[model samples]
Target chain A: MESVGELGESGVLGRVLARMGEARAAVVGPGDDCAVLRVRGDAVVTTDTMIEGPDFRLAWHDGFELGWKLAATNLSDVAAMGAVPTALTLALAVPHDTPVALLERVAEGLDAACRVLAPGCGVIGGDLGRAPVVTAAVTAIGELEGRAPVLRSGARPGDVVAYAGELGLAGLGLSLLFSEAADADGTAHDRTIAELWARHPEVLAAQLAPAPPIPLGPIAARAGACAMMDVSDSLSIDADRLARASGVRVRLETERLEGAFGAQQGVRVPVDAMLTGGEDHGLLAVFPADVELPVGFAAIGSVHEGDGVRLDAAALEPRGWDPYTVRPPGS
Target chain B: MESVGELGESGVLGRVLARMGEARAAVVGPGDDCAVLRVRGDAVVTTDTMIEGPDFRLAWHDGFELGWKLAATNLSDVAAMGAVPTALTLALAVPHDTPVALLERVAEGLDAACRVLAPGCGVIGGDLGRAPVVTAAVTAIGELEGRAPVLRSGARPGDVVAYAGELGLAGLGLSLLFSEAADADGTAHDRTIAELWARHPEVLAAQLAPAPPIPLGPIAARAGACAMMDVSDSLSIDADRLARASGVRVRLETERLEGAFGAQQGVRVPVDAMLTGGEDHGLLAVFPADVELPVGFAAIGSVHEGDGVRLDAAALEPRGWDPYTVRPPGS
Candidate 1:
């Protein structure tokens, strides 16, 4: 089925629709001009697009993984808004030579992602077209359930900075993939690295298919979160963004994150990776100093009356994943 | 700037944010992970994508026109559902070589389109990234306002078929652009074509920057429309889809459509164009037999117990704008 032309656009869409089960939030699903969804109070909408060359490599990721990541990335945005993701719409633009089978795999991956990460959230509608390269735009609709949405600019002085998901593991995994440690001979030194890799397969999964801390968003919101956002870029860069938006200084204790970095034995993880590695899709939030940290969340930093971001009182370089600024290794 | 690379992604986004004034529906607009919107009851969601080569030609359409068409297409979907468009989000994936000014112009066009067609509905959020070609994914959110949504599958036997907005003018204009009538020289005796082009500039505008009858959606629904859809593809093809979905036959009077085609005098508009010309973004509706037609709508056909669409009681071809099946000329 190389090139969806074999099945044609409608055929491919029919197969995709068949794969989708049901969304509880959708009053009416696919086949209509619009998907009618039941909403309470406020509706949350977010959109994210992932392009082939800049966002991923076919050699490193397959259609299933791509589809999962696509859902994760978009759902994470809804989660960051402190809403329950109810429905999703995808617009896929693929090359004329792309396979229909790959799209099915992608659909399966989307279903699997929703099942594991966001149960009851189903893809209700989508648009398919041909492009020179594969690109996907996912629009997620979430309901606030009468709660106020947590904004990035709501953090204040004397707030405790907390995090709920893995930190820098995805970035470290990416580094490992780029490094030559995997190609080494079975020498003692190479064996140490291989053993670490075998023992810590979750690190690889973090990079390939990150299960973001989505549920934590509502928890933090209900717990009186002052400000919140997902850690998509590096911690330092994203922290600086939060600080700039809130007009406060973010001070992180580097020692707190050392535990995650030290999980792998024999192989030393770079401090830069822990500080600036992106694609973690973790929840970073702030709360009042007296507020109790929720389960699965760790107090890592504090907010003070100042500017910029700091790691143990030292200024950290503010750089994160900017598609226009970063180029792929060869390209 | 010649390329978006000059300003970087963030810089471009800042410029775009500056252009968007305010959205009444959005509680939290751009600059956040998700845009929070106010909803009454059921939320209507629709998505559409336009690509460079297949959707438009840079020689004929500019970024502004592309932006307007993009918004028009998505909003029309909302209207077809008998909903009021509330908010919109776009994900633009353009080549790195695309001009930043062009993107700004596109933003302006989006704002202008919203202002003219669906005032008070605004673009609340969007994403920008690099792609091999210029591709845009626009997702529109609408509110049904506590009323039951008009679906395409709701048409019944003995329903009256009505249409609001232009029919084949856009397609005819497209034909004219590709026809020899556009040639500068007045050598041949194609005076009829030249006179038609000189007389009806609105036809070209209808093709390029169509101001669709979006506000009539709620009106038609209040008038007790049973089924509704936006005619994005050829009327014959889309009508057939509606008929098949509803398990009924739509009988369109060629005499009724003749008035639409006759607007372009002296130009022998192809019958095929009238039947199959798409991208007009007109509203087609089915109403109860005794329901009075809306102000802008004219009854053009009738519904009966059958399985396919008919033209003056004759079966029409079951074909329309299927991207996979229809290749652009010369591409």
Candidate 2:
């Protein structure tokens, strides 16, 4: 896995895309030029941004990767919403003396990503200026084929809670990066990421690149996902969110999850990570009890009559990484 | 006009958004705690960020405004795209010893903004860490009514180039604070930011608090705007963008611009700032030759078959403010 703070730059995105599922409105998702969504109308608008050190590391990710990631991250959001992404507006703040080439690469990555993921969406406007660190912001819009949207608040009690994307790879990879940073040697190493990284060379890619389920979000929503949300946070946290929004308790069937997801241990984070670790970009969804979901979803949890989070029999703790409560690497 | 960098936190944003036209999708924008867009789909997504030296003034802006602005800025973008923003993800980097109250205010701002804009969006996911300065990245996802989005490149030649928002107040207000770094007097200007600001308080207000035309973008687009763009950059620069993207040149009628624009200038920057300034957040659009534009738009320019820019009859030589070619401020 790429180190949280010192991860390398290139070749991490592909792996992230390989493991992600598809949403309906999204014609394209991660690893593409841009994540394309089908907007209801002809007009499409989009935006993007990059943060200084926290979003990336100068050591592990390169300028180019950061560029691609920044654009990919925002494009994913638009994709998740089922809008046809048409144009992007970038708000960039960087150090005064940053290398021109680095900025160019970042721009290049943005352009390249748009071309691949969502050809319909083009880079139309960008804001560039000086700052102490490099940061970018992007926002994207898409067309929904004139359908009712999919929302997290729409789930109900007895809804079949399912997931259409990878569970905990990013959380696990991020943890590995932090642990490695704490490791005196600091050489990048993650059993799951190494294997996947070599093949796709993009496993930890999930950690850095953030391959969003651009199309799957709308798809799940349209496929009768009563309630749906992107799992950019802890599974337990997001589940709790869905539960709270739907006014129900979510009883995640640990046994079913164990049966279906234990094989990928490296990617399979600690249950705590699975419950609370963030930034996986997966989707947690609730569906009608009887209707079969679209092709990508795996049912591992069910909604119940309760409050907050629960795993097996016990109420889960809100232990996801928090800025006020958690201590990140190199802080 | 506002500077790209000035304005104490939300002040700059307020300036940019002050004169924007409403979109059919936007339930709220900028002035609200959180901006809302009508969602065509069930789910809405959004993002926001805080820049240290630029978006926030270490000497001027407070932590709460920082947080609020971080969330609001991104939410504004979502509104611009005609999406009802839901859920926010943040990435923050700051010194370990940063005051907890400051962070709390930032969170409070986030919470407040969400409560106002998209209660559903709230503080869903975020990453917190350390850096020399404080910076926050927040992304807001919005849902839009089943309508097509408005794009910056959609304007056609011969379309009346009009705007649904004001221009250059942010730049004007920013000028008051631009030289604060070099001011040897070191007067206690930072202590009372409210009073010792610019002469044209409205102009400065535009810089500090931009009025985004949340509803106007989609409206203008649908109203036969050949093209539509947010006036984050100077009207001139952004207009140039429309021209280049549309494969046409724009003839900005300075007299008409003078009659329509607020903040009457003396000798300098009337035309220059109007044309080349940044952060206005106005809409620059082109419409069919005979079509009537929506309310708030006055014809300030026309799109002709040419390359680059023009002011009246003269060839508008860009002063390096083009999206891809702007020189660093100090340079």
- The TM-score each candidate achieves on chain A is 0.89, 0.75
User: Deviation in angstroms for A105 in model 2?
Assistant: 5.2
DockQ-based CAPRI category assigned to the predicted complex of candidate 1: high
* Residue A115 miss distance in model 1 (angstroms): 1.0
lDDT of 1 by residue, B17-93 (tens): 67665678889989888999999879999998888876765555667888888889888999999999999898888
Model 2, stretches more than 4 Å misplaced? A1-38, A41-50, A63-90, A100-125, A154-157, A183-203, A210-215, A265-273, A321-331, B1-331
Best by lDDT: 1
Per-candidate interface DockQ score: 0.83, 0.13
Model 2 chain A weakest 10-residue run by lDDT: A3-12
Q: Which stretches of candidate 1 lie over 4 Å from their true place?
A: A180-200, A259-271, A321-331, B180-200, B259-261, B264-272, B319-331
- The alpha-carbon deviation from the true structure for residue B146 of candidate 2, after best TM-score superposition, in angstroms, is 12
Give one digit per residue, the lDDT tens place, for model 2 in A197-292. 564333467666656556676577577676666675578777777677678888887777766555443544445556666776666777899979
Clashing pairs in 1: A3-A98
List model 2 lDDT by residue over B1-331, tens digit each: 3322233324333332332223444433332111334444433333334566545576655555555556556655555554445545455556656665466556766666555544455543334445567766655555545555444455566667776666765565555555442233422146446564544556554555555555565566456665565665466666666676667778888888877773443423466667666665666667788888788778888877777778889887654233223332542
The residue-by-residue lDDT of candidate 1 on A1-331, one tens digit each, is 4568777788888887677667889899998989999998798899989988788766556788888999998888898888989999989888877888888888888888888888889999989988998888999989899999999999899999988787777876665555433233211123334554576667667887889978888888999898999999888988998999999999988787665444533445555666777998888899999999888788888999999988897887787644334432332
